[model samples]
Target: MRHSVRPRAAALAILLVPAVGIAATPLRIVAEDYPPFLRDTGKGLTGPYADAFRLLMRRQGVEVNYQTLPMKRVFQQVAMQPGTCALAVNYAPGEAETLIYVGKVAPITLTVYVRQTQSEPITNIEQLRSRPVGAINIAEIRDLLGTAGIAFTPVDRPALGIPMLNAGRFDAFISDTRPDVQFIGGRGRPVKAFTLARAERWVACHAAMAPATLAMLRRALREGVFAAETLPVWHSYGMDSFFLETRQQWLQPAN
Candidate 1:
């Protein structure tokens, strides 16, 4: 009876081992609606980062599911929820503790824009101190401008701000480098009016993510998912051209 009982116990332990392993580790990914980068296809989520993440995670043997929300809410959820991560955000000063930076998936630029017909050039943030510069409410752009002591008129979304600038409702508008141009061009609005800022963009992850996951993402980025040769598709999209150009400059072999 003792021999039979020992064999039965061993068999039960073997059966439970795989289940325990499966429950112990699984990957959950949180995404937001940042068009051309991340968008809901209705059938499912799809975008440049989404596609790259899927491929990279597969290589790492991790399964993933994506959830889309407003950009502000996405950051908030990631900060408050455990085992959650948000993507495609830039590294801002105060945000270091709130999010873990995986690695730069891409290089971005932040620029300020005004109507082409406007007589004066916006050479510095100080120029806009009293003027109403439109930006997405509660976004990194707002934070950056605020830190620089530049006051702005907050708007609900980037699209609204662009049109408002064109309509002369605001003196200027601030936006991510690529999207601003692409969005303007797509709408057949004047594109030559905008100028790139001196500041460059950096990719970052939520600080609340697990260190292991963050390290895995960093390794994957270094292995070159965001490399020029790997993601040429981004160039066809008007906005990502700026991102592609910046990536080339930053990732070039050091002489």
Candidate 2:
């Protein structure tokens, strides 16, 4: 059965507002090329999370312009540009003051991937200490590793991690959960993954955004646009549990 976040009376009124009357300037969305969430496929921006965001904005009669860039650049643009937002941004202490999170997009659990030949069993974050590890060069993951007192080399992309591991660049690679790691690991280069950290990623906008615009986004999110649009994609990935668990976060607006 389909479910939506229960809305407050005020927010329900916002949702009821006519889409045609709310036509305003297009919102500029800055996104990272994170596969299965947001990707630039060389043709255009397309991904489950990105599609859901686009759908909500369209339903609200708001035009949006999307640009794909490195995750680092995505954060920079959203921080500096007014009326700009980023998709699936993990919350960080330093960035919290600079950004206003509208709602949770999805849950991202970081995993440690290693060559199948490795002997040690790594079921926790402390096991990664002293071993060579590489992770995407992003502040969120860096903060995660830093908090655990683990050091890691920063890889420019997640796709590069497996190849680098095969070349012995690092003993382990930390990345978001991906199903194709086994295929990418290939013959004689099998890979194994361990859960390291878990957290939620959100749709965050610049602090300078107009209050009305922000309200519209919050309204759409609280009304369950995230689940409505991305449910199929999550199902396709066999992650119905993730979708079910995150529905609670969607009910509450970000502070």
- Top candidate on TM-score is 2
Query: TM-scores of the models, in the given order?
Result: 0.70, 0.73
lDDT by residue (1-255, candidate 1, tens digit) is: 000112233223223322222324556666666655666777566655566555555555565677877766766777777777666655565666786656656554556777767787776667878888776564567667877887778875566677788888877777663344444454424233344343433335556666777777676667334554334334323325554555667677531
- Residue 174 deviation, candidate 1, in Å? 1.0
Off by over 4 Å in 2: 1-24, 41-43, 166-168, 181-193, 223-226, 232-255
Query: lDDT of each structure?
Result: 0.58, 0.68
User: Mind giving the per-residue lDDT tens digits that candidate 2 earns over 140-198?
Assistant: 68888888888889876676777887778888888774535223434435365677767
Task: Pick the lDDT winner.
Answer: 2
Model 2, global lDDT: 0.68
